[model samples]
Target: METDLLIIGGGPAGLHAALTADRAGARVVVADESFSLGGQLRQQTQWLSNLPGQYGYGKKRGTWVNEQLINQVGASNVQVLKKHTMIGSYLNGNIGVSDGDKTFEIQSRKNIIAPGAQEEAKVFPGWTLPGVMTAGAAQILINREKVLPGKRAVMVGSNDFSLEVARQLNSCGITVEAIVEEKNQIICSDGELVKTLENVPVYTNSTIEIVTGAGEVEHVVIQTPDGLKEVNVDLVCIANGFSPILEPFEIMNCHFVYQKELGGWLAAYNIHLQTTNPSCYIAGNAAGITDFGSILLTGEIAALSALEAMGFISSAEGTEQKSRCWRELANLESEKVLQARTEMLADYHQKHELDLPDYFMKIKGGKMYG
Candidate 1:
């Protein structure tokens, strides 16, 4: 297939990008691996407020916003290719994609790659057992699939993600027996939300020594500050941090850098979300890890950057949209992430100007020498 612009990943970033580009009269095509759009937003039951555009304070749920985007895109002229996965990427700008039946290549004038992030797992003994899964998996089961993960659950982290999932599980009538935190205090900054988990006992400075079960998760032994405590639960939710899915960028030969704060290795890009390959832009968690609000803004910025580069939009127009998105993103993102991004962009630009060394050869897993 051939198009003016191709967006990979129908998540928030790619959906927003498709809408932005389509509005600018670009023939846009969005290919996603999922049957439905919205990516992680589909499983998010959180209330999203204070977003930059089309959302007001206490107005929209995450799924509602996702639906709005989907509906808007559906009403537009852009083409949607669901259940399509990118299998190969070439330096010449041709992308090989598969729809489970056959492989095909797509050629586009410009591309926006926003394959999103993957949930990180901290494995322990018996983690491979049934009913033991990542927090995201549990969320999909309850929120999207409309199925209960377990009647009794134990959340294995105290971060915001863990707490939010715990809250959701509790709301679904699943008894969150305990929240085990290796840190001395709760890591979630939302005081009000943390209060929801107050009734659910929190074991600070605790680690899961083992999870025992016959065929499913039956009990978990946590090494607390005092001693080993056993909690009986059917489900074990591992709510660790997330890591950017870099396979898309890696296949495209995009430069990568390690930024621990941004969720490990991510594509090196500029303020405009343009990677080392000028034709290819990245957004959302594929660029760096941030909240949903910031991810939306980054998608707009990336599309604007691509539109300007393709001469579909004026420089002034692109700059105006980007400035507005950046302003909103600044408010939604953390100071640490913003600072780290500044450093990462500076490094990317500096290296982009220099010649690559001989050691920069193709490595396994599609990751080249950095």
Candidate 2:
């Protein structure tokens, strides 16, 4: 299929990018592997409001916004290829997209790769049991499918994402036994404090030694700093951080470095949102972890950058859009969200025998930087 632009993934990033590019007068084709358009929205049941000014694009914002975005995209009449996955990305700019048994060749003047992140799973005894599932999967089962993951559940993870997932489970009438945290402290943001107090105490510095049940999970033996504790639960939800879905980038040969802060090996890209390969761009959790405000703005910046490259917009127009992108981008930098990403991209440049961008070198700490 030939298009002015092709967006891979139907997540918040990709959907927003599609709207932006379409507004710029591009015939857009959005290819997402999911049967529906709302990516993580289907799995979420929380409302995170942004601080008045930047619009309603904040972390964990309500499902209403998700519905609003989807509605706008539908009303705009952009062609959506649902259940279509961009399977193979080649160095020559041609991509292979698959829905089921068939794969099609996609050629576009510009492409935005917003394939989103893959929620990770941790290894534990009997983790392969029937009722053992990723926190994301549990969310989907409850929020999207309207089916309970299990009657009672034990959550495993230390971050706000896990804690929020636990609260969602409880709201759905699923009894939560406990939340297992690998870190010694809770990572929930100040606003998220109420979730930890929702009748679910966190078990810090803990590990599930074993899960016992006949066919499905019945209970788990947790070993914590104090001692062994037996918890009875029907399900175990793993809420570990995610790894960016780099397969699309890798198909285009975007080099990645081991950056733990970004959740593992991440694609090399600069602040402008351009990858090492100039033609491909990435955003959202697909690149690294950051707030939802940054995610939406990055998607816009990435689309504008692609538009600039494709000569769809004038240089002056590009600059105007850039000012907005940079301003929003700055909102995330000092917060430790994009710090590791900047350092990693610099490292990627150094590994390729290139110099780090002048301004970025100073940002990584004066004495610690090379």
What TM-scores do the predictions have? 0.93, 0.89
Highest lDDT: give the candidate number.
Answer: 1
- Tell how far residue 194 is off in model 2, in angstroms: 4.3
Global lDDT for candidate 2? 0.77
Per-residue lDDT of candidate 1, residues 1-370 (tens digit): 8999999999998999899999999999999999999999998879865576556666478898898899999899999999999998765778889999999989999899999999988889999999999999999999999999999999989888899999999999999999999999999988888998789999999999999999999999999989999989999999888989988888888888899989989888876788888789999888888888878888998999999999999988887777667766765676777667656765765676743222211211122212
* Model 2 alpha-carbon drift over 4 Å, by segment: 51-60, 90-92, 191-198, 332-334, 345-370
TM-score of 1: 0.93
The digit string of per-residue lDDT tens for model 2 on 1-370 reads 8898888888878888888888888888899888888788655567754421345445545476567668979988579999898889655678889889888788887778887788888998899999999988998898888999898889888677777788888878998888888788776775545544567767889889999899989979999999998988999999888888888888887777677777787777765677887778887778787655566777887888888788889867876776656554554443465677666666666666665434444445322312
- Which 10-residue span in candidate 2 carries the lowest summed lDDT? 361-370
Q: Count steric clashes of candidate 1.
A: 0
